[model samples]
Target: MNNIDGLDSWDGDRDQSVVLSEELRSRLAPPLKIGNFSVHSRVLQAPLSGVTDLVFRRLVRRYAPDSMTYTEMVQASGVHHARSLKKIMDVDPAERPVSIQLFDCRPDFLAEAAEMAVAQEADTIDINMGCPVNKITKNGGGSSLLRDPETAEAIVKTVVDAVHVPVTVKTRIGWDENEITILDFAQRMQDAGAAMITIHARTRSQGYKGAAQWEWIRKVKQQLTIPVIANGDITSIASAVACLEATEADGVMCSRATLGNPFLVGEIDYFLKTGKLKPKPTIAERLICAKEHLQSLYDYKGKRGIYQARKHMTWYAKGFPGSSELRGKLCRVDSVEEGHALIDSALASLA
Candidate 1:
């Protein structure tokens, strides 16, 4: 298989060994057996809409080949009735050991989507019960499931029976502070046969605000028989370590943090396994990745590729000088050449 810039191969960079030796106080990792799949890596890539596309996943897979990655959440109702959704569910062969996440509250529709995911060669099917968007909630999907555990569990039971693959769930603590029902709700899901659970430690009302409630993750882990994956508010190596240390979750999944930094998933997974920080990618490395991402978007979407790449380029440009202005310019780019020139100029300024 041709590697994208040798993504699957890494010899570790300078100080890699030294850093590994420094973080020897190993955290207890929960070993989860979901159906016939076993993941040795603790950090999973939480499915983010529009962000966890095939190209973005390829970037992340390069650094953390074995770490579990997720596609952007697929709408089951849409997938059941539309060909466009099926195209979105497509996974590259290089992204083996990956899970396809789906949303919607209808058990029957979700079941059909699950079967489709199986046909597409997914190792697992993930149900999304944590999205807070008004549209999704209004449709009785996403975080709205928190308001109706009965329906959520039914979706799981139906989907589990429909597919031979393991079915998992990604959800929040509750719909809002007043509706905290995670402990009981999670138990119901477990009873209904969800193989694994990923809990983003905040209520839907919080909407990615406040500190992630690591304590809630600890509570779920203590209450559930399956592996409990912790997510939310983790963006850096230190935060990743802290999330694991505080929650005692079986694994950590980086959502927004993995946005521009594809190397994060593998870097953290490697640190957990070998206790080391791989060498940081330099400015040149970032520029190369940005260009490759631009080209891939072009390949994936044709003339509209520039529009799709704008957000990705903006995400990659974070933590650099003139980033915000560059993002504005990138968002307005209508051609691939212009996007490339903007990124090249940004990289040159950094040098």
Candidate 2:
């Protein structure tokens, strides 16, 4: 396969050492069964708040058509009080196998919000028990649930009863280094009727730093009868392979690594299925995607989308010659036209 400019093939010594053994291929070949729902791909696109919006998910879906995608985590209380679907909960009908993620400490509000999500055609309801943001935790939500497993269990049981679709959870290992409570937490979730549990492998104190503790995932996988997805630090096909082999978990979820790189889930999924790496997108192709993303965001959300597109544009402007200067300009773009012009100029330079 052709390699992109400034991009290396997966034939490097490190990647070469990490092969997809026949055992792994056979193990992952079957559809991932979650409750009564079945997902054909072992790879999943994670629910990133403010990042996995409908526009971004559309791009990811274009590549990983069989993989499951998630909506940005919606505040259950916000939806319950407003009695209206939040734009963040929006899922295109065509994006099958997509889950609507909800966060809050109140089981009643979450159950009410889940019914609304099902009305919008959600394939599953995901509880956000693992978010580390203080804003979420301070209000008796997110990772704070780790400290309150009783409430977490109650939330899961209530939502499962309220929704026809399966109820799942995404969470970190524990409150901090001293409290690695995922072993007990994962089992409790299963008993409470969670169809699946995604473990982020980091404590709440670690935030996004430090290496993910995959060993904990192995321990959880051993105990839980439900499918366990390993979620921290899975950035590439190599890391995905290593994590799967080490944890022997059911699947992998792509997180921060997919920022500007929507092709990641598809790349990893292709490798797992075919044992071959798909060619990386060239800098020119990446810039073109950035332009499309900028325009689409503008078309969808207007002025506010332009502001949001700034971070996304900068994310795509990397690794090529003059990329530092290009990122500087892309991050300050005031309009879609300006952003398109900047990417066009960068593409011309690469040519």
Candidate 3:
């Protein structure tokens, strides 16, 4: 395996250095306090469905030890009826600063799920009010909560009362451009006892398209006292610092940017803490990480994990020679050995 440490020289054109302003550095210097829990690093790993399982998070934790990470959003109703949901909520005790993100319209079910999350030793309970999937929204959960602030508030208040650990909310700016209600909605969540709020900065209708309207996050942060984390378009250290400066956000969370590169969170965290840029991983190193990810998923979930690894493998096979061809081959891989062979072949070619 080609470890990141083995790579000393990188293409300077590919890695741009970001200068952190004194004001921004001083502002983010202190620990991010979520209720009573303190996370040393301001950068967080967003809870991505099917992508942020224990196998993936362990890889992320290897790079960003003190940063907070979240479980993929679990359906509160699923937890209420099925024991199988436990697999998604699985948290390693070593991953101390992790949160279990749960989504539902029902306050009781969310509260029950929060309790289960605490038992799993989650550092905090994050309510997913920002997911924009139609299935989630039509079900009266996710970003739909942005439209129904009453239930959203009730969910937060109920869960805060139900759990001993901090309860945070991750939400979008609004349902759509015409209904940008984040200011009022964010206030309601804070009033309802939310310790922190992470703003995705896009309307639910956008569903991740368009430039994230970061200005809305700036507005919400002004009206709230709790730590505000800026999400959406936070891909690189440059973008993270830019967002924090633009929004005056307490932190920035990495979402889609971390798809194939788990090193992103730590890269931003290191830059924020020390005003130094970490070297970007070479393509060969990335392929090696992808190979390890494929094997780890297989070790954890057997054949089903390989099916999931297909997408992840494709995400890794990019930005290099023959990557397009490699991705096409990777997405159809059926076994760990097959995936390893493809990545190994890519690595050998890079060498």
Candidate 4:
């Protein structure tokens, strides 16, 4: 198993659905209330930078209709300075329960961004405090806020005051193993009027590597009065159930696992709502989705979308024979027709 489009780990038996504990099921049955806002589903789609664009969101929404979804993180300064809102901040009116996520260390800029987000019909405003990328952290935003609790608190407080919609924060547990400061950080966010907190259960240093230390989520949940969402490693229903039972957080948010698999959140959501498991998409069905995703990306962003679709196309070309070769070809696709042809051929071969 040579990594093959990076889905080697996901090839495990999909038949074994994790049974939710009676206590966990009972606890999560109600709508998750974030201040005045209420979402019918506990499972949420995490905002992935360079992903979670309007097209991607629409695909996820089709399956997980009631789950909350987020836009990619927007720069608060960008939102404040631009004459018009950036395309990344775009949210469809029909996409209910959508939260617009903004990142920056400047409280005033973040406040201004939140106002713009509300005008765009965001259900809530989410502050991004957990992005570990060098560019974001060096700019005094993202997970760096974890190191500066005061600035993070001010951002939340300011945004909450500026917008009628509920304000929330998504952050990592700490900067590293030595600075595991989430216990205090989460408390400060709640006190600063953040309506909900989503904790990515790894330090900034981990950066999607290593196992997510879920114990930190349990600790944060014990202290927060606001809804606490447990994120990180929530790739499947089994992982979602395990995290909920272990941490007892208000909900789970799906991230990297959803890069090519938009059905994951819906599958987990359906399982939580009903005890039965949703069937995994067959290879042909997945390729069909891949084709649709490619076409939509092209429709939205033109050539740039096709270029960006390359990576996404590769992500979808997995879990079947010849998938590795297909990924190799799809990653170099130069046009919508080229991408579609490659996927169609793959499907034909499988058929």
> Which RMSD values do the candidates have, in order?
5.7, 3.7, 4.3, 1.8
lDDT of 4 by residue, 237-260 (tens): 888888888999999999888878
Query: How far out, in Å, is residue 279 in model 1?
Result: 1.0
Scanning candidate 1 in windows of ten residues, the lowest lDDT window is 1-10
The number of clashing residue pairs in model 3 is 0
What lDDT does each candidate get?
Answer: 0.80, 0.89, 0.89, 0.90
User: Which ten-residue region of model 2 has the weakest summed lDDT?
Assistant: 1-10
lDDT of 1 by residue, 8-27 (tens): 12222333333332333354
TM-score of each: 0.90, 0.96, 0.95, 0.97
On TM-score, the stronger of 3 and 4 is 4
For candidate 4, which ten residues in a row score worst on lDDT? 1-10
Give lDDT: candidate 4, residue 234. 83
Clash counts per candidate, in order, are 2, 1, 0, 0
Error of 1 at 261 (Å): 1.5
The positional error of residue 60 in candidate 3, measured at the CA in angstroms, is 0.8
TM-score of 2: 0.96
**TM-score-based ranking:** 4, 2, 3, 1
